[model samples]
Target: MNSTGKESRHVNIHIASPVEEVYSYASDPANLPEWALGLGGSIENVDGQWVAESSSMGRVVVTFSPENDLGVLDHDVTLPSGETVHNPVRVIADGAGSDVVFTLRRRPGMSDSDFRRDADMVAADLARLKALTEPGQGPR
Candidate 1:
């Protein structure tokens, strides 16, 4: 588990491969868009696309990691409020698989209901990522 001062959330999964494989798959931004949103939560919709810098809301930076052979996704996103947040996503070898960690330092000032909804949304997204990064798996 990862517990950093203000921003660390640990999400671990026992993948069936080495850490390198998991890392390689996650570094690509294009490949990443597939797992960006989970089943119910969408980063885009019929009315708007999350990739757009500006949707109905003010301009939001749709930033992502630059593609690299190594599976390191250290991307920072800035909300419309001018709050630049670093989404620390790290992958480490754990036993026969990899342990993935994602963290957000300060609270986004979201409501309690929003928290629960976001948690479920992220949890589902992580599951989708696990399946996508593993070998012999298709887009989630």
Candidate 2:
């Protein structure tokens, strides 16, 4: 999602995988770089919360947990200037998979660069998880 306060971007994707499996992977701090490599443009997370402190894109941390079957990520992230923002990212199981919706709320004066990057990364992560959860087929 991208926004300038008056307007923002909203990106949504539906992943074809069990909610539990996706949640497990998405919730794990270790798997972040695997899907969202540009989060820090190379600077890795070394914080106790597994947040990136040296990356130009700042740290994107996890704060919400799916309801075992329905994943909701209500995350709080800090900006470069010590400002905090809210991310209401929700993943709901649909049929044999799950649908994700992520919303980023901030004042209008902020740039959407990070929001766009974060949304794209999240979508990629879901895609990777979908591949991992596919049955009768192995990860390639």
Candidate 3:
């Protein structure tokens, strides 16, 4: 929680890879399902939109930020209810590796349990990303 009255948590993981490599992998919408299990089991580019068909929240559309050198992997997920949730993510250089950070915000009227669950899911997703981007993971 901050001065904005919105409760939030920063869930992050240190990946054993360079910022460019990690950002390149994470920024690609096609590679999302391999790491972002919280989003869905699979995703496809429907026309120009990225749709997650098997998402727990039902079919949702994901819009990602344009690729840049700053390592920003932010995205917006549009729920079935027509509400769009902005997810802020970043990959920062950390020595020879990189730290991937996700800012998880609690929506209004959400229960404490639900917020915690979302945080856990984000942490798990980061872990999976770390595994995939690590040195021995090869080219994912």
Candidate 4:
């Protein structure tokens, strides 16, 4: 935890793809289910809002940042209880490839095991992203 009493972990992965390509792929909500399994197995747009019906936290709404060249894929997930969790994600250029990072924050009153679980989930999602974006692995 930092001096502000906020506990966070930066879970990231290196993808063997250009930053632009990775950002384009990761920024689209339609492609989320293909890699972001931690969010859900499927997602659909409902009246301009992305809704994931089978997410781990049950049905939830996801709001992504506006499209930009900064590789910012930040999104807010509104839980069933109406609480919104802001997830900070980024795809940065790393030579010929890109480095995708997800900052997982520990919620208030959360247990140690829960924080670890969230970190593991984020790590797995990044790995999936790497698999899907890397050359000769899966679809571009």
| Number of clashing pairs per prediction, in order | 1, 5, 0, 0
Model 1 residue 34 CA deviation in Å: 0.9
TM-score of each: 0.65, 0.65, 0.93, 0.94
Error of 4 at 71 (Å): 0.6
Over 32-58, each residue of candidate 3 has an lDDT whose tens digit, in order, gives: 889999999999989999999754799
Candidate 3 regions exceeding 4 Å error are 1-5, 137-139
Best by TM-score: 4
Regions of candidate 4 where Cα sits further than 4 Å from its true position: 1-5
**Alpha-carbon deviation at 83 in model 2, angstroms:** 0.9
Residue pairs with clashing backbones, model 1: 23-71
The all-Cα superposition gives candidate 4 an RMSD in Å to the true structure of 2.1
Per-residue accuracy of model 4 over 1-140 as CA lDDT, tens digit each: 23342888999999989999999989989999998988999999999899997646999999999999999999999999998999999999999999998988877777788788889988998988988889998888
Q: Candidate 2 on 7-125: residue-level lDDT in tens?
A: 54565666777767666666665665555454433323455544654355455553334335448655566666766666676767889977767664546555567556556765665
lDDT of 4: 0.90
TM-score of 1: 0.65
* Tens digits of lDDT, candidate 1, 1-78: 122334334544566667777777766444554675521222332243234233323444545666554546676656
lDDT of 3 at 63: 96
RMSD of 3: 2.3
What's model 2's overall lDDT? 0.58
Between candidates 2 and 3, the one scoring higher on lDDT is: 3
Clashes of 3: 0
